[model samples]
Target: MDEECSAFIDRDGDFMEVMCCDYGFRSGASRMYQQENDGRIPKNAFQLGWDNFKSELRSLRQSIRFDDYSTISEANPPRTPMSRAAYSVGQAALDSLDAVDRALEAAQVLEPLRPRAVTLDGVTRDSESGSKLINNCAEIRSKLKQLKLSNKAMWDREHAREQSGRGVETPWLIKGVYLSLCLLLDFLYENRPIQRFWFLETVARMPYFSYISMLHLYESLGWWRAGAELRKIHFAEEWNELHHLQIMESLGGDQLWFDRFAAQHAAILYYWILLGLYVFSPRLAYNFSELIEYHAVDTYGEFVDANEELLKSLPPPLVAAVYYRSQDLYMFDSFQTSQPMQNPRRPSCKTLYDVFKNICDDEMEHVKTMKACQDETVSQDIITRREDGPRVGL
Candidate 1:
């Protein structure tokens, strides 16, 4: 669709000249504009040219939707020649869009087509996720089919300015990828392992590779939000209580153990955020990267970084179980952002990716508690020495 739009515009101007070229529409200099042979769609040229110009104009209109650019001339913004030229160009584009929308109404012959990536209603039936979620996922797919938009068409209007030599920030698709990943994360945590595995396989079966497209999108989320969302969502509906109960019983009836248990579980759930946003999300989606950054970057980033440092202070044995989990996360992040497929989720094992993250989170909580115990033991030893007359020989 986009290529067609571009083509119509590029060749539209010489429509009349080309239309009558072989029959002597113009004698010499004007013939340069007209091909002697029937080089293009003769009759369609005029309408196509006008339609192309109209598209350029519409692109400009969409851009001016941002209010920040308007106050430039009025607010004495950028007084520089380049800035002034850009402002002038933006205004001109807006005017052209409105004018062309009206004038070129008769010109356009080609209707816009859906973006190639928008197929499968954005996701497929998760028969791969197992029969349990297959129905549910199929329903979700049905819902999105009607909602698919041409907004993100590969010919996205966001890149319009770049065509005109403007250095504008073509909006990144990161937010879209982030949202898709979050959904994947959500489903993974919401469902059991079999269900999750099936869904990943379902994703792998899709026509387009969406991982790289989304990895760039998910990197900006808040550190804890995705993870926190994972924890809360599972609990939002009634929990299995079986897992909770089993863990409690294994702790030998200690209430303190229960407190620690719940905390650990809660923390463990947090890792799903990372898995969803970074590793498992699909790519045919968009969300505000700002929202993700707002949720993830500060506290969660700190937590992950700080905990890694704290983990270093632990005894090797205590750290050993969870240490590898953190390594997994590092590995996951590295793997997620690699080439063409950003966060290219591996087909077979990615189901465990979220699960491993969940485990890592719990392990970290355990480590934190162990560190506290170690500190308490040292403090107690000092107190005992003080009570014992503080090393009298010394």
Candidate 2:
């Protein structure tokens, strides 16, 4: 297995090497990798503003022009004189604006406060990251299609599993909301599996964010101080989900503007909802999270099984490799309350398949933790500390 994994990595390394030349190390599959700037100067405010202004203009022009404008040049002209004049004026105006922007940049009147280049850690720091990520993701999707993996088929299997058994008993309202959200996802992302996972991960972190917020509020009001450990675990869980979200993003999951807008707004709403639930009943909040986590486990499990061969053929995203194979796993072990503190989950990230498998396992661990929280037994679960070893706590 080790030899086979090495061979797979070696086989894919050539493609990545060539791809990286065009889309920097900070773009595409490796976009999420932290970039260190040794001596490069940061872009000034004026330069940044000009770039954004140009980008907006380009977007607006693209929206107005439905067809390709590239073919219309000196050799081939616009059909009407009015249209030709309009194009010429627009091009000249753009050129003048560019020249003015260049002059302003040369003057350096609006210098950036931070002139020195710094390490960029955010996954979406590079503007081209999403498009580049999507390019690589398209290849993976093509392979999956060749293998006959169907999103509808995957959804039906999960739906059948839900129908066969009562997974989690909750209030009618909670169950209704869960069902509605699941159905919405099925509808909105019918044939786009990666985008569906992206949306799921985007909202997945909200529960933990809300839980941490509520716990912090309780401590601030002096109502409780025992949840410090719980907050740590929740943060770890949020961090885990964040990586999942980034992994999806690196897979071109968030390439569409509509998808981003929808996922972000939904995440914010989910956060507030979870916060309200936590304020009223912590047990209920945990139960809600447990339901979602269970669903995630099933969804990812089905996805993995359905596209096993294709996934294994693709290389794991850089974010997955960094997170799963990191030297520091204190955060990773902190959330798995069901496992013995001494035995932490150290999942591999040799292929995309392993990444999804690890994520599925992570969601199952989340289910156990949520159940423990609801039953008030999480306090007894061992909390693993890097320096202090295993100690019983929340």
Candidate 3:
């Protein structure tokens, strides 16, 4: 249906480009930009100043979201992201997901199937047991179908738009790193979009981590006190990415041992490299991140277009349900610098399609922020309490 519609362009040009299913038109991007910069918390949140109270509350809330999914599960579910036939399909998909849980439970007794490194723990016996375990896995896999994205031709066409130069130029070193990462991903994740997204989210969190680390270090040394606000915003950005990582995990993206090992190690290496780059020249670091983020936007955009049907059939992961519909949405709005000061983003997460769509839009937010950081005029006030940080959106 989306293939038949022209790209929706906002007359105001403040919203992200949305592609609605029923209308064969674009939608969500406009809603995401309807943001407000109101710095007030619940009137009774705390007795202290709203700013200080919200800051502490956000940190405490982040910790709970990561460490206490138990509490989140107990919270009431949000409004469903889909309805009618799509909702029924999502429910069926969720029912089928039980198969995944059962398979994991069945594999638990097989030490070889576990993610931990194999050791000399009762390994010399039980050939029959090993064969039995293999047969069970095969049976489980046979009952399940791997999810796949369709419409590759559309993806290719949209991706080609990125290939056409849009006035984006990069330094040789930055370009080299970007190209090398692309090659690495193509080699590792060919034909595996879920795992590829898992790796990308893992690596994507590093730049914000590095940025926050440098900001904290500078402040600790009394070299910079101005970046306090920026730190808060960056921390929120990192927190957002963390939820994205967890959502991918829940989808079983980290099932392969090699993939887990490779992504983790690469993330560590990337962090240090970004840290060094940030220390040497902040502009260069921001520039590098901008290029990477822009590419991420394209990649996720392609994935969404390609996988529309399969994704719409799947229910969103629990983590996504919590993050998108959580009562505490300040963190979500903090990272979207491009939205208006009064309207906050409230993206739906009813199906896997909506989840990935929101993620793609979030990447665009990061791209806008990174680009703002690169601008000299924008950089001067990004860390300060000003309405004009950077004008960027979908």
Tens digit per residue, CA lDDT, model 2, 270-313: 99998988889998999999889988887888888977978888
Stretches of model 3 off by over 4 angstroms after superposition: 1-145, 149-159, 163-167, 376-394
Cα lDDT, model 1, residue 91 = 77
State the weakest 10-residue window (summed lDDT) of model 1.
16-25
Top of the candidates by TM-score: 2
Report lDDT per candidate. Answer: 0.29, 0.69, 0.62
Q: Against the hidden true structure, what lDDT does model 2 obtain?
A: 0.69
Q: Residue by residue across 1-394, what tens digits does model 3's lDDT show?
A: 1222123222233322222221101112211221342343454545546765554344333333233222222222334555345545644554554454446447873111222222212322246654444444333332222544333443464468657854346799888988788778765565566767788888989999999999999999999987776777788788888877876765556655446667888999999999999999998888888877777777788777766887776555545666776566767877776665556678877677898999989988887787777775444434342553332211
User: How much does candidate 2 score in TM-score?
Assistant: 0.68
Per-prediction backbone clash count: 26, 0, 12
Winner of 1 and 2 under TM-score: 2
